[model samples]
Target chain A: MLETLPLSLDAVRDVAKECFDDGWRLVTMSANQIDDAHFDVIYHYDKDLTMKHYRLTVPKETVVPSISPVYFAALLVENEIRDQFGICFSDIVLDFGGALYLEEEVRAMPFCKVSVAQKQS
Target chain B: MARTILPFGPQHPVLPEPLHLKLTIENETVVEALPTLGYVHRGLEKLCEIRDFNQMIQIVERVCGICSCLHALCYCEGVEQIMGVEVPRRAKYLRTIWGELHRMHSHLLWLGLFADAFGFESLFMQFWRIRERIMDIMEATCGNRVVVSVNVIGGVRRDLSPEQCQWIEEQLAISEKELKQLSDTILSDYTVKKRTVGVGVLTKEQAYQLGAAGPTLRGSGWAQDVRQTGYAAFGELGFEPIVEYGCDSYARSAVRFRETLQSIDLVRLAIARMPAGETAADVAGAMEDDTPKPVSAGERRDIMQAYNRDKRHRFVTAPPPNLDLPAGHVAAKVKGKPDGEAVTRVEQPRGELLYYIKGNGSKNMERVRIRTPTFANIPPLLAMLPGCELADVPVIVLSIDPCISCTER
Candidate 1:
């Protein structure tokens, strides 16, 4: 049977806190936008030996907090979402500015093309 | 000491593709290095939105010339998860056999190039020559030197005949002997050791923290490998990740050299345990009894309209009888849908490559993103290079086997 570890909405920060304070090495954080209300955040953590995958979901505007200080990799992933999609991090300060993929003239922030007028513009 | 920034590539003798990295050097030591990417951006993720799942199989194979099997396997595993299709054991073994062969060739090919970079022409030729032998075997089986488009949605595209199977065993046996000797030579060679030892060390803590998988993390005393996850026939045969602990350039080289032996062993094990049955998975033909019916008429008409409105890629009927797909997501999230999304990780020759597929529920996918191993490994390179001398950069980079094309793809 397929297994999954479900966490409550309020437990998001605590989950990151346990992993960050523990010996688990924070590997990655992939925030997948399911829809306007559903956003799945897949937290990838590993130690010297084993790796763990933790998934948490929140509403579109719901800020579940950032694991930046706990796991540095999460910071980059969060920034990628900000740059690619327009998902705002509550207080995380990540320096991800620069032309990583798209050109300068074609909208600086994420979700630029997602808008119809901007896409046609 | 004075510091200066020297640009290394996008165009350099050591690197093949366009990977421009500027290194800040103080005397002979590099203080800081900044790497800029995306010169070879093909927007592959965007391309997938247009191509259907079946055609995307062929396109994903082109993601990287080497270790294409892993990409296809990851894609298949993702698709299989969505479609809820279980590949037969025979096909799993075939996946293992070809996957290991690809690993052996990729490592050896990287080894040859590394030797050439160090001006060791003879060693370079020796390794490349052995790699070519394996490449020839791969060509005979998969009909391609680099990108072998063998993977399909349900299972494999080509089934190996008895003669072809026997040929693979024979080729691996010879390659095994040559690789063993090469490993010995590489380990003991005074110059190879002198150049590689104590250069570019990624500590155990550093490796773990940075999320370096496969040989990179393994070289740093961590034996973690995704193969143990048993994606294919890996579970059938006892497959352990080849690991080393020294955590330096020599340790990295030794780890790869040892892995070559491991890959050959795996291929041998796979061939010996190979079962005789239909290697082909039926694919589209298997849909009749599949839990989810192929795509439904109503859904197809709606999705077709969505595709037409996009003015990009749309699914077309193959003719004869057009099957309807069941409502809700038919396959696993990896195969993608118009509504769901998936992130699949596969252990490539270098390390772990992650594929994130987001579906919008239409016939065509919405967005397909990839986070390659090389992109992840580059940060560690920043950490690894600072302590090492300028001369060792080429070998260190080569040891990681940075396929800039794979990263940019």
Candidate 2:
């Protein structure tokens, strides 16, 4: 019956903490850059007792904050967000570069990139 | 001081889709699994901007081939939420019919892959053969083999005749017999039990919290099914998520196999109870010149609400021959002017799928991001792999039914 609809960036950690504490493991983190100025990242939670959704937004060009320290699943989704969108996580376990599936050419397209998307300056 | 980094698949033999994962394995155990995705982001959100709401279903279906109809289902549901259109009752039942049919085939396909994972050629071959019957039913009812184009904004594009319904029932009957045999063998077979049982156990508690969706979560003793949302015409119909509590690979297989049988029953029920009604809505395009107008939020909500009524639908909402999806919704300036952004989540076949759509109300979307199930479920996979022998990786991974395309798409 509880729907998070859309959560704020400041509340991202609190929601993740509560969801994880409440026994809902973080499944995946989905993100997309709205434009050059803003980015939206969604943390998907999976718990038997609860079925709901939550999200957070960050500045598109800002340095990456590590959610992986709190949730491991966050790392995979982060890597994907970085690759497609070119947003870089400041410090983490892996570099998470290269086209996991896409090719060099496809990666160059604006639409082909993702949340932590990177474009040549 | 020593860790082996192994790159597994973008196009490996075991994997059907192209997901490149780099696993830091120590002594055959995964220390860390780094997944590299985004090979499949086809700019669907941007495509949404260029393509009118009507053509979006065909585009959305291509997002995930395995769950093509469901992709359309989620998109329609999302749009319908914005618009407030009410679809007819008959269209809802028919949508359920195709949706269940898609679930059965997808699970059957995964079952075959699981069997193949352990090199059980006979079981693999047998399971796949039965899947063909379901595909035949799909072709008979919808025409296309995989993309089924059954979802339109207002309702389905076609309806089932009495004879077609009877034929579908008969084929489902045949599929049930084979699926039952398959489940029996999977449950009692020593080889399968030896390989799958107790392997990759994701406790019910774990399944729910992880935001896992579909059979993967359900197989682990947790009930997380999207059909319960009753999108399309599911509100009038009755269906349950096929579940198992064994929390192992075997149980996962059983959940899918059993669900295949359930789908047959559901299809029979839908066909038997179907009421006659108009399959397509009148959607005609009335655009004389390239005139652009800002669509009001109220209009957007109405359009999405209308779509909600058409959820899980297999028909297309054709704007009365001349008038297409109002150019108002298309050329209209949105609230954000590319300032506002939103994320969309749906229960995909594998698990929870997230699509982040950000628009600038421009010709192209500002950004589009997706969170696929495999990427999210990878953590549990690493947790399941540490103690198991390297041989079990294939089966355990297969249990999740990772469609790297969805992850990348």
Candidate 3:
């Protein structure tokens, strides 16, 4: 079962840090394009076979704080979200500068609905 | 001393799939390795926006050819959970049987490839020869060797008869005997030990911090496996997670080898305790009399011809109306369309595969997020590569059994 806790961007770092301190494993991070302006970023944590999800809603241009400082594995998922959705994370330990998955020739943020809409227009 | 840059594959003979790694080497030791992917990216998650939940199973199965069954199983489970449909008991047991078979085949394939990576050509042949028998069983039972599309939203799409089950038992016994002999050599062989022992070591703490999964994590002494969570019929079959504490390339390979044998035993147990009943649930509000009628041979041939003529087009659309589906194929039917989100996690052969599906009370899903095992395992692979010598790169990479198709999907 998955439990979603909606938290402000400010609370994300604290919640993530607490989860890390409590020995929760960071499973993976997922980003959904809720709209043209807002995106939902979910951090999935697993402990003792139970899954807890922290959902943070941010605008397109917001630079979310990196959780890699807490869980080192978050670097990969954060970089992947940066590459796919064009969501930037501040102070990533190993920043690929948005070149982790996609090549430069491909349009930025291919998974973003806003980009698709813009392309259509 | 100057650092030399070595680019390892978007295409390399050692790699079965395309993955690019830029290794910065100084005096034959890798200082750092940077990975870049997307060579085989097909934008499959994006396709979910157009295809309905029912049609998305075919696409999900293509996420990784090696662990195709688990992909479909996870996706179907998520959708079924969303619709609150309880799969039939018999179907659940059958899914366990087939899932174990797929795991065995996949591990054997990985063992064969790993053997070849270290130039054990004869061992490679033996492992692959055993794998072919498993593939034959899959083809005979599910009709497709690689992407066995036997999972529907309500339950599985196929059943095993008693005679077929007996044949499977006989084949597994023979393969198990052969694997026992192979494992003896793999574990004790001097050359294999020299190459693998004390090489590319990942301690338990590092593995956890790096988020390694499957055998990679188990090799470092972690007994974490999603199968223990009791999805499908694993809860009934008494599954156990295999682990090793060597924390080296050898330990990773040994974990897979033992897991393959364990899967064979699980299949045997599943067949023995097989439940008797219908193989699929007539989902809520579904037509009770809308049973699928078998297509004629001529219609089957025509459909096959069309499928071959334009395979890419079929990737984007639903299966043809008059296609000859295998027996026990059930069209997913539900009381209402999926309106909320659900997350499903399954133990793929490589590691944990997670799926997040959200629907907006329509035929088409709003978002489908797949966090495949290889995608999560990449950071760990990169973390292990930096301290190793150039010659050990391929061995360490193959030790993770990286599935690039799954990663790029």
Number of the top candidate by lDDT?
3
Task: State residue B159's C-alpha deviation in candidate 3, in Å.
Answer: 1.1
Docking class of 1: acceptable
The RMSD (Cα, Å) of candidate 3 is 6.6
Misplaced by over 4 Å in model 2 are A1-10, A23-36, A42-57, A90-109, A112-121, B1-7, B23-32, B38-46, B282-347, B354-370
- TM-score of chain A for the candidates in order shown: 0.68, 0.66, 0.89
**How much TM-score does chain B earn in each model?**
0.85, 0.80, 0.89
Worst 10 residues of 3 chain B by lDDT: B285-294
**Lowest lDDT block of 10, candidate 2 chain B:** B323-332
lDDT of 1 by residue, B1-409 (tens): 7888888787878787787777888888888777677688675655665576666777778888888988888887676665456776777888888888888898998888878878888998999989988988777777687888777666676667666777778878888888878876788898888888788899998876665656778889988777776778888888788888989877877878888888888888888898876554543211322132364467546654333455666668643222222223222122333345555666787877776665555545555666667766766676788866777777777777788777767
- What is the full ranking by DockQ, best candidate first? 3, 2, 1
Q: Which wins on lDDT, candidate 1 or candidate 3?
A: 3
Tens digit of lDDT per residue, candidate 3, span B1-409?
Answer: 8999999998887899999999999999999998878788888999887677677999999989989999999988888877778998888988888888999999999999998898998999999999998998898788799999999878877778787888889989999999999987789999988889978888888888777878898999999999999999999987889999999999999999999999999999999999898788866622233333454577546655333565555466643223233455554445556667889998989998899988766767788899888777787888888889999998998999899889878
Worst 10 residues of 1 chain B by lDDT: B325-334
Model 2 clash number: 68
Query: Judged by TM-score relative to the true structure, which candidate is superior, 1 or 3?
Result: 3
Better of 1 and 3 by DockQ: 3
